[model samples]
Target: MSELENTFNFSELEDDGLDIAAIFGDTGTAEPLPIPEPEPADAPEDTGESAPEAERSQKQPAPEVEKKDAQADGETDLFAALAAGPKEAAKPARNDQKATGQVSLFDKPPIFSYGGAKDAIEDTSMTFEELRIAKADDFPELAEGKKVSWTVEYGKTTKVIADPKGTTIASIKEEIEKSRAFLDALKKAKEKDRNPDCLVKPKVTAQSKGIAGYKGVFSTVEEAKRSDKTICLIPARDGRVYEFRKTEMGDFIAPKDNVIEFSAVRAGFTPALPLIPRDLMGQIISFFRCFMNEWEEFEALAHIYWDKEQEEYTVFIPRQRVSKARIDADLRGSALPEERYIHYADIHSHNSMAAKFSHTDDQDEKATRLYFVVGHLERFYPSITARMSCGGKYHEIDPSLVLEGIGEEFPADWLEQVERCESRSDTLLRKKDFLHAFAALGDMPEESRL
Candidate 1:
């Protein structure tokens, strides 16, 4: 008997998850191990064997013990390979059992959370207006002190691509003007409601008409009216058309009311601030009367000033070269006021002639300023006239516009009842020949305009 067989009993293994079938791999029904003929006690046992068989028996005994030891070592190695199992990849399932192996923590999908830091939450979930109108309490992490310190972004925006010269527009307002757009929309709505569109198109007509070599629409009455056509017709709208006819005096004549058109607008040196305590005109009148002479006439000069620090209108009598007709003063010379004081006007006396601007006055008073002329000093109430010189152009203004105590209060309704009556007059020059730039307001008669 083999010594290894005596040491281990093959039938005494416990069923403790050890795979004996795996250790001893796939022993099929074809074959079992060949046990060599053991060495006989005396001579080799021979029945009717050949002579070669007897020779093999002598060599077999020599290696019989060695063969048993080699087989025992190979079987022992099979038990050691049990834990390693099969080297081939495992099949998916056996007996409908689930396949399982060592699983990684990262193998499963990550669980998203909205309760972490403010930055950890995704911003793509909210829209632009939603972020603008939403409050801090609307967020989960930022609400109820979930985190003491956190940051959120809404007003600012990051560019999808970096640009060096990108610009953003921001609106600024002193007050929250919530209803301005609403008011404009309401006005447009009201206009549309009141005056809906006039869907009917206007009737347009084209005709062949010509006269006096002026082929199209006649600009003048002579062209529009021919020998056969005694009168000219025109499409009339809401306006006045003055008919100027050549009179015997070789002048185109029209009503004075229709010819003269003007409107009142304030210009250089309007009386906005109050005058100083000293009455400058009264002082000038007193000084003129105090130095009145019956011989030749002399002129005096004064300038009106406004002091920024004092916010008052003052008068300074400047030294000048004066005569009966002319008075010249160095306005911007050494006698000029300081930078804080603004020179507003220039006034001079004409001694005794009517308060009218002479040719010399227009030539000398070219600077932009208010000008005043006092005349008829011999009378109890001297005459005064006020005008503004705007860049060499002159405009006559009411004396009360600048001079105090020059007019009296009157009822407003009296203007409607007043009527101007004068004799007929004509000019030697035509209206086109003597035309200058002037504001032409619409024709507003006393009855309708008042």
Candidate 2:
């Protein structure tokens, strides 16, 4: 017998010889009960005993009525017969149905009534114009002949390309990507814009402000970095302030005052970065290192809070409540405690796969302040990509900037173990090898792992 089958003995149950039939009545098929026969009618009672032959012959028979007279007066005879006494009850009409299970034309089936007075107020259908109006937002479109020009900023009202009539919110969002303004804005340390040109912005005022007063859209870097700031500002009609700088040419022909320096406003508020100690940074690195060799993805959540005694911000690594993990990991919102911390950061490993923020992730973290993606986890130096969403814009920030007191080099053993486990031909075949490597490190337990 196999080790598993031998480990559990089920022979005792069979030896018991349970009597299922006796316990729950006879198991043999039961005979149907016979229907009883109907009772016969009772005989009438005799008045007297049998008489002699002479006495019986003297008895007279009942006089019969004339059939001709009765036939002549059938109506009178029927009345006379009815007045005499009530006759035996006539047999009831046959009530047996055809039993064909098909609906009969003669049958009157019940009908359901689903309408009332309220139904009269409802319209069955709507026109195309009515549908368009119902779906439209408050943004007004420019007239046919009217044309306007506006500069594209990553985090401002200039993010959108056109009004509602010209394009939809989804189409304008595509422009944000094609324009490549998001990366440029990050490089310039500017605000991020959700809407590009062809897509519609979300309904929320904070999300929708990026394209509020947009007229003409400038998406290309060449157009955005145009030397002539006056032209870009002229179309916007905003009171934009600018500065002039002296070029190689002397002030005689082209003066410094003629040049424009900048024509945009800075953000009003920016999220503060937390101070992560070297120990916490190492802990976070170690936590992310667990999935370096695995083909699947894993995620972690870090809560940042102010340490009252230390007078510095500390990083709190909470238990990851991951809803799902494969190519991408979705961390459960319930894992994050509401009252404990006002600021939190979500970090996830991408397992050397897709490194960019997916559309789903963008929607999920649109309001998050700090988010990081660790890719190429099996490499010597892991790939770290971090972005901060604040003031209605996303800005790319370096890990070194936020993660302080951390050296570039990681432990040699960590990299070796990751590489060795990832070298397996089939990840499923070497699950034990991966587990043993982490177990040897003694950083976490098997039950607590992803």
Candidate 3:
């Protein structure tokens, strides 16, 4: 038993020796290793001697290890990496850690209090009171007791959010006043209902045919002679053709004729004049008396002037004269001729002129001279005149005698003058130069007869 125990003890001692050998091999021959000194937190003190190449190699690893330690502890290695210059990139951040929560300046509750007081309460809920306080605090300067009376947009419509006082109401009233004034001025500018001062009234005349004394207004003598009703002549002051049936109260109104009244005159008025001839005064007086039934009520006189060069006679009846004549003629029983006669000197064949005066439709041997007995009285007495000259001849007067006279021996110069007169007359007629032709006749020499 003792020998077996000695053998066990010897084996254990050998096992212990082998373990010690293994440890020595790993620790580089089993000497006690010296501890390394920690680097100073401050910058290293500079030495006069340059560091050895081996020491520099060792120092490079020291800075890198220190930088890694700093980054692991959440310290920035900005200076260490900057010292590395362009050779190294900045270290990447670690994303495994939980992030710190952010604190917002807007999240806190406001300080203002409103309504009834209550037990202290948490301000986590977004209540109306809490919201109002938050708004006030956000715009502290502008929100201090300053109600939002209205909000005015730069280019859009204004909005009235809160009426702290009557400021908005006052602004609205001012705008309404301006609008009303504008409307008043617009109404004045329209001036819609004003009446015109002047008016037009037409007068008409009625006439009957074969009724000797029946007076009428007719554009032509034949028309006057054909109508059965007592002719009423209503002359138009405006020269427009007015129908008798269209006139209101036409029957009660007396027919107006001869003299034109001042009230009846209008803008662009032109008077109609007679185209016949007689003693200048007699022709005018006769025209007025025949047409004007109220001549006695209005005294009127006709003024006549001869334009010898024009071979025309112009008659002017003044307003005063018309009024006076209306009074005189209306009272007077005798009626004057509405038409007048015009006579030209007989100068054709002297013998034929004499023969024409004696016979009706006389065909004389020397010349074909005609005579005319022209007058307003022709309707009453067709044979009032004996001899009259026309176209350079004398003839027995007839109502329809258009050609006055003819001459077999005309002077050569006289023929030329006649030709010129005929040409001028033709041009005047074509151009509707009635007024000019009348003036031309006056320009002709008295001796130059045609």
Best by lDDT: 1
- Highest TM-score: which candidate? 1
Prediction 1 global C-alpha lDDT: 0.47
Question: Which order, best to worst by lDDT?
Answer: 1, 2, 3
**lDDT per prediction?**
0.47, 0.41, 0.33
Candidate 1 local lDDT, residue 240: 36
RMSD of each: 32.6, 34.9, 42.7
User: Can you write out model 3's per-residue Cα lDDT over 236-334, one digit (the tens) per residue?
Assistant: 565543222213344333334433222344322121333334455345334533533422222233433334545565554433323321211232432
Cα-based TM-score, every candidate: 0.32, 0.28, 0.11
TM-score ranking of the models = 1, 2, 3
lDDT (10s digit) by residue, model 2, range 1-450: 432322322233213442212112221233233434335444434546455654565454322223322222211222232233212110010111222232211121111112121111112133212223443342233111123221223232245334434543323322443344542442343122221222122221222223224222344324534543322222122322222222456211112232233344543324364555667655766776675544555554555555544556656665445422333334456343445454546666665554566566676667756777766666766677778877436777766667664457877788666544455567766897888887776876767666
Query: Tens digit of lDDT per residue, candidate 1, span 85-181?
Result: 3221111112112222322111111111234322221333333223323433544333322122212211121112111112111111101112244
Model 3 residue 13 CA deviation in Å = 99
